[model samples]
Target: PPGISMAEEARYGFGQPATEADIKAWNIDITPTGEGLPPGRGTVRQGAAVYSNKCAACHGPTGTEGPKDRLVGGHGSLATEHPVKTIGSYWPYATTLYDYIFRAMPFTAPQSLTADEVYSLVAWLLHQNGIIPATMVVDAQTLPNVTMPNRDGFVADPRPDVESRE
Candidate 1:
């Protein structure tokens, strides 16, 4: 320890403990069962407007010509060699779509979309993907029940260490 003169431990103490309100505000996770989905509604018509304003620049007018990840079509193509993994073709749950948009989207600003805006985006995306009709209104309650095409495509892994609950 001749050359190692240890200085006193440095404690920056930069921040205070998060209060309950802070924790609650940040807990915005939405489950597949739609547990944490906020109260908001969006129709396909309204979603079209929202998409044109907020999303078209990146995702394209049709959600297909994306400079980013493609969001529409690609149905029944997952098993093909050139599988176009899109939201309709790959996503298993719609609630997670809401969760994702709420958490990160629009490319320019993450977590900047309001619940209503997120809902509208979800509605537009789903409509483009042919999952829901144009007349359909997507809300927290109906969103969880909108079954994705690939919902049953995923099978549970049978691990030796994990016993089957059934």
Candidate 2:
């Protein structure tokens, strides 16, 4: 209270609200139902090229062989003691994959890939995991429909899930 001032408080009311473009740019969240999906498309074939140029360095030639968290295979290993919870093995919804890549991916630059590029990556990852055909093109409509292997495995927990004070 000694160092605080009323001027600081007044400044809080002086700031301008976020513009429409600014709101849209920051509100890039995609839903499991494929809501909020940007208009774009990417095929597993084109994703192959995108992945090679932008993703392979971290995720390896294929999504599975990468040094980072593997994005392919491990389809039936969830119940095993050593479960590999990859995008295919553990992800519940396909659009969630798109959301993740669009929000944070490529390790080098976050939120850098275009909607189409992210779509391609999702397709290739799904293809590598045998969830979809290699020629499949992931767009808003098809992406939300590509269910993952563990879609029904996760049980919703309705609880007092507020953040702990710790």
Candidate 3:
């Protein structure tokens, strides 16, 4: 925290100044909306094959049998004493799914999947969880529209409660 004033950093920076383009390039964050959904598409059938080849090794063939994380099922278990929070059970949004896969996945390799591959993986996972039909395709338009089962399960964060009502 010491010797890191904003003025000093702006005047004579110890590192190279980043351009607007550079900032955007590094800002790969995708919103809950369809913000970063690239122009790509993938069907459930196609996703099945992709998952078998690329993801099943880690997440299991059905996503529910994974040693890493069980992505499917676990609905209505939140009320139980020992709940199983999973993608089908606890994820709030589908865009978050797309974003996560795009940024970090495969365990062995991150940022390795193309836009299409990411879409396919999301589709497969959603379909395995029964969120979408096997015939359904995931794309920029469809991915954001997917509503997770536990969408309303999370309560709003009650932080900064004393903020001024300006």
Candidate 4:
């Protein structure tokens, strides 16, 4: 303590350690198994309205004509010369989709949507992708069961020799 300069000590003391509540609030990650999913539910019909109001401007009215990343269609195009990687054709888990929409969607305002809104968006997107029926409701219990088209298409990375930076 005596050897360290005041400037160095001041630099280290700049920020306070995060509290448990702070960590909990920031820990909104959702796994592929729907673990850590929040409590809420949404229907395809409800999602359509949320998408129109919050998502259409950047992602297009249909999620395909997107000025941003396309969210639908592109099924079975992975092997083509021009593979159109969309949510329906590419994402492996519906729960992960919910995670993405919940964390970094609407482009302008990230992490602003309610859990119900996120669920609704996922339901509508899955319905648009033909992965789910229009009448299906999406929630923690049901969302994990909705399989993506490319679920079996992805292979585990064979490079165990490579170390993860994380």
Return the TM-score for each candidate structure. 0.82, 0.82, 0.81, 0.83
TM-score of 4: 0.83
lDDT of 4 by residue, 57-154 (tens): 88899999989888899988999998989889999888888888888887789999999999999999999999999999899999998878998888
Give RMSD (Å) of candidate 3 vs. truth: 7.2
lDDT of each: 0.88, 0.85, 0.85, 0.90
lDDT of 1 by residue, 1-166 (tens): 2553345235554688899999888998999999988888988888899889988999899999988989998888988899998898999998989998878887788789888888888998998899999988889889999999999888888667766796
Score residue 138 of candidate 3 by CA lDDT: 91
1-166: candidate 2 lDDT, tens digit per residue: 4775898766756667799998987898888888998898999888888889988888878777768878887878988999988888898888888888878887779899988899888888888888999778789889888878889988779788887896
Model 1: weakest 10-residue lDDT segment is: 1-10
Report per-prediction Cα RMSD to one decimal.
9.1, 7.0, 7.2, 6.9
Give the winner by TM-score: 2 or 4.
4
Question: Which of candidates 3 and 4 reaches a greater TM-score?
Answer: 4
Q: Pick the lDDT winner.
A: 4
Per-residue CA lDDT of candidate 3, range 1-166, in tens?
Answer: 5878898867755677889998876676678888867788988888888789988998888898878888898988989998988888899898898889878888788888888888888998888887999888899998888888888878889988886976
Q: List the residue pairs that clash in candidate 4.
A: none
In candidate 4, residue 165 scores what lDDT? 96
Clash tally, candidates in order? 0, 1, 0, 0
Q: Choose the strongest candidate by TM-score.
A: 4
